[model samples]
Target: MINKYNNSNKDVKYLYKNFLNIGQVGLLDKFDFSEDKIVQAKKCTLYTESGREILDLTSGFGTQNLGYNNDKIISERIAFANNNELPFSRLFFNEDVAKLAKKISSMLPGSLQYSFFSNSGAEANEGALKLAFKYHNGQRKLLIHNKDSFHGKLIATSQITNSPEVYFDFQSSLETDCIDLSNTDLLEEKVLKNKDNIYAIIIEPFSASLARPIDFKTLLKIQEICNREDIVLIFDEVYSGFFRTSNLFYFMNESDLLPDIVTYSKSFGGGISSVSGYTTKEKVFTKAYGSQKDALLHSSTYSNYVEESRVALKALSIFSNTNFQEEINQKRKYFIKKIHEITNLKYVESLTGDGFHWGIGFEKIKLLNLDKLLKLLPLEITKDPRFAEKLYVSSIINELYRKYNILSYAGFNSEIKLFISPPIIISEQEIDHAVESIIKTVEKKPLVLMTSFVQNYLLRFLNKN
Candidate 1:
């Protein structure tokens, strides 16, 4: 067990603090057992250096849909190594690339036949935006996005993102506008008012970041408007695609409406390869990059590599071959029933479910009587009313991991949201364990929770100094 990474002479935590991101260190290095070091992962479980098993509920932020180090997915990597295939040369004639693109196209409904490969979700979305502009020959000057969503951190994608925390303040290259999805009437008016300048509308079918769900009627209205006005509709499914949200693609299961383009990543790589792509209809692709002169205009050096495509092909196979509707339906029902039982717990405020994605809101601080403790905490987090609730939720997240072996985290929801995004491969037994643990954790008085959170931070600070 004394490997190079786990060597006694080398301190990984020190390296992370000095060389890597210190903030990121807390993601794995907290809870009551802060000394425990996770050295191995398999099938939704993380093993510490001392052999402690921690059930992973975050799914590595939804990238591990099939669980960690999945055997079937690793087989693809082994096959490629034995064959000594082209890992990367920017070659245009690889069979796996064509096969992957075709496989992705076939799984989706309608005329989404063309694909532009990339290395991340942001790149794919950026490409989709570019395609929209080219499709209109620069005649369109505006893009519409939702204020409750996030697309990516890249320049163009960041502009479209509306979340206050992550959204940047700089001006955008394109004229961007926002709409409130809750009001369908205002949504229609916004689009009609800017019909001439509008080129595309991008939205997340399911806002996995915050466990937000879209109404079927609103979706249809947007589809109708886009179709009538010849505007492009793009679905940013980076976090919710590839059966992570209980569907092959979230939009397809909800309704028969088809989007002009769909950007995908995260689970598409099967927790192995880092591959992403945006799929669109043949007509859109032809209008944007059909000519031989423009076909390779937007290509990336690392866009279509053999190894990534092979692994992605196997990942897609696992997703497509399995019949998940029955499994998702049964598991979701069991989880919902359990959540309903815990709705009246002492600290539990609101509980909502959407497939495997869920949100558990905590009661505000004023009701919790944490005024004294709130004054003692750092000014940065305590000053904002919005962030105060976040700290309250963080306490629950900490206790959830400290007392129980389960891991949960705060979502990007505007309110005090404790998001539980478990892996799709989770079992009935695992679900029972997680639900029971949550109930026990919430039953504790909020005052006790806040006290523990303060102590945890104090401990971290002392150790750092």
Candidate 2:
């Protein structure tokens, strides 16, 4: 049985040991959080084993959009538990699953009327890939993916991802073409060059790592190209989905382009269950898996999990409310303003992103002879290399957690950006406190920042060993 522990140092050691045993030692060392035990989370604040309160700006990497321990959503889960509902089998029809499917299909704007439920963003992308490939009758040879776009870590998605350094060992079986979505000329050139062999062009409207919206003209141009080439256009909205982007979907209120397929997972389950899905048009579905024999072809045990389905349905209902969206918008405006205030600091390069999702980027100050030292590192250390930007971002993340008790994320792109994805329900007071804490965190003495860098370097050295 899982029981809460009030022990501080002892619990931390046990957790670290278990993390090491699970091969997550490097991940734990990388962040180097000041406090290692979180016993409970209430709304936007996390409570430690010692009963210290820490603001959770990470929002579980944007999954806890509605915040933790949400009573309303939890009540739904309690009801399901009381009913003692059995897990739905793939071979049989489930009313709750069918209701959720209809609700999702009808809720999506535009022509996206079909959806396939799964357990993760990666699984959803896997489903999307299978559909895209099958729709073309298996003749299309290449998938055009954008730079800095993170679709998933699965086989097909990993191959198409631009962040090869992060997935060095998990190599892709199929060849893929890459293009920078920010450069319109380069994007058109690559797409047109590989249009004949391309099955689909997948991208995020605003990639979380890049932390900026893609130019609308570029999206329109890609859409036009995909239309002319008969290639499916897919949007990986796993991170940018829900009202996280100030829009229901990033492509909804922001752009006029309608993608053939869209995948979402992060916030869709209301932070209560593991659920994800991909939406597509009826024609695309018909072409891909319309026949009776093919209907059950792409499925897994967790595809129709009843508990997750019920929670997802409730979450969708919550997201559909207009009043809740307006309240989120109100909070988002204040959140952006508070973040903007911190950008005035000398170390801060800029703040980028939309709505409640933003990243704080630091000014890049080159270290002398760093590249030479990096070159001398072992081949295994060099294989899935971490760049200067990622290290700098990691330092900032560590400093924030250590000094201010605010959890944040570090971007992995060429320019490291510290990400904040606080719950939309966070109050203006909480926002002010977080901003003030960050201001102090960023304004730390040069010696403090240097120590953070040293800690990071030592961790990397340990990783190398």
Candidate 3:
């Protein structure tokens, strides 16, 4: 198989189609203006092989919060290459493990003393659940998670994801926690009913994709319930942590409420390293894996990585700087004020989220005879419920990329109308350009954008295929 296209097929597209993933190509195929080969990236800008300079607003889905190729973050990786020294090992006593654990513990709430490292959000979540089960000594039978919560894709975590698309939730495996936070009593009822059997309840404090935060009032109530019921409360801040949403942690903005375990990844690696971790209270850590006998029980081979630790340490320092936060705050206020103005448009139905991430629900404004004209197409593809949404969003995204060279993304799940979450490091000029591009794109008639998109997409598709 390797020999079939080893040297004969040097095309990157061909390599992806044959050896890599065909789905990735299929996903990108829908976006005509997507860069095929990005040659360089620094700060909020991406340089492509086609000599195009794109302003990246998605921040690699919240991984590159410090911006791409950050000088400070990159220097750590460079030092790692130059020195190549092993800072610590998983087997014997590890300095990085101790240092990072202590460092994160100091910044967070006083009780969140111990930490465990992993490779990704899902792994961190899986570890969190394992810790909960171990804390209960495998006596508990249920794990609770919020509806529409995306903890991870690993089988255990997937069971609680509640995603209908890629990560289909095994509804029967895990118990549903709460959805209608407005009902106030809904969470308490479930927690009380399952208190004896529920080991842990996972929650996403701020969902960046949907641009929604679990209400602070509801969170305070959950904290009270968890304290009384002995259920481990886990806050999965994979995509929302590391000042991606203006605050160091979403929960920090309002009042002080700590969870039993907090799983974090994404920007924790400083946009370069792959590191995820869960910090838990000392009691939870000791009760779960206190003894040396169970210490190695729930550990990954890649956990406690020294290079990753070095990167994370540097990233943490960068995040802790007062000047850095001040600059980001100014940009954040500008972005919020600008995005808030979009709600005035009749097309925008709802607005959620805050800081750098926002989800705007758009409703179609019926045209005189555009539907009739669209119905005449070869297939009535517009009949799907999401067709209008996809049309409006995809068109806007494509236009932004093509005309303004700005990159943005749609929210996740079934009802993803629009998600606008740019990198925190984005400049005022870039924000102005990106927001204006979106406004102009949305202002266009859906039919007009669709026609242009189809033609351009076909042109690009034909040029490549």
Winning model by lDDT: 1
Model 1 score (lDDT): 0.80
**Could you tell me which 10 consecutive residues in candidate 2 have the lowest summed lDDT?**
376-385
- Candidate 1 lDDT score at position 254: 61
TM-score of each: 0.93, 0.89, 0.91
Give a tens-digit lDDT track for model 2, residues 303-329: 868889999999988888989888888
**Which has the greatest TM-score?**
1
Off by more than 4 A, model 3: 1-10, 167-182, 365-384
Give the per-residue Cα lDDT of candidate 3 at 151: 77
| Model 3 residue 194 CA deviation in Å | 2.5
Ranking by TM-score: 1, 3, 2
Q: Give the TM-score of candidate 2.
A: 0.89
lDDT of 3 by residue, 310-405 (tens): 899898888888898899899899988888777776567888887888888877645444575456443555665566567667877888888888
Candidate 2 yields a Cα-based lDDT of 0.79
Give lDDT: candidate 1, residue 186: 85
